[model samples]
Target: MTAPHHDLRQLQRQAGELDVRLAAARHTATSADQLVTAVVTGQGKLVDLRIDDRALYGANAQKLGLGIVEAVRNARNAARASSLPELNALFGLQPPPPVAGTAPPLPPAPLSPPPQARESVQRQAEPDDESFEEFDFLTDEEPESGGGRW
Candidate 1:
């Protein structure tokens, strides 16, 4: 077989390095007013959260709540983004803005084995002798005593 390309090996190495970085770090993000801070870790853990008391002021309570939600999601996005170089290199793509909802692609399933040969191989693998015993209901009938429960 021909030797694999050097570029492929380099990409693999870059991906490995990126994976290591991703495993050890986290990301933090806050809303526009700095009222909330959200932290997310490499293994998808939400490590810490902080919200300013002023965030709940008067008419802005709803906006503050929305900001908090946005902060948390953005924090996770940042973490995923931090690891994107590795992911892109690994997948041989330019890269994408990683997000919390995005799941890594799963490997494709292998092709099915040929049906006729598969059946033949299965038949050969099975034992030649087969069991066909059946139980009879009266095989162990006991002599009844009319005096007691039957």
Candidate 2:
């Protein structure tokens, strides 16, 4: 194959460096109620959480948990949104246009061997002959029927 163009190589190098920087970037957000805060990396990992003491005392456990989850989601969303344009441009990504009132087509099913051919292959791999029957280890005398150990 022909060598890549110098300009293309340069672009790829720049994209790689940008990817490293983006992965290290972090975004933070507080919950709507101002009771929870979360920090998330651009890669969508939650790195830190801070919950106000008032949140624990004033709200039910479930309500406080929900607030924390919401804060993390908001932080991740902000992080992703900030990098989306640059990442898309660097990778030359163009999302498909939306199709109105119709669901996206399903992926095609995987191809498979015919059932008869599959069975034939399995049968060929198995040894049907009783060659092992030549051995007679069960010919030993029967155990004594007495209750006491022999």
Q: Which TM-score value belongs to model 1?
A: 0.46
Instruction: Go through the candidates in order and give the C-alpha RMSD of each one to the true structure.
Output: 20.4, 18.7
The C-alpha stretches of model 1 lying farther than 4 A from their native spots are 1-20, 94-150
lDDT winner among the candidates?
2
lDDT of 1 by residue, 1-150 (tens): 235677678767876776676767777777667888888876446888898988777545546666777777777767665665546646767655455334452232223468897777667765643322222223354334222112
How does each model score on TM-score?
A: 0.46, 0.53
Q: Cα lDDT for residue 61, model 2? A: 40
Give all candidates' CA lDDT scores.
0.62, 0.65
In model 2, how large is the Cα lDDT of residue 50? 94
How much does candidate 2 score in TM-score? 0.53
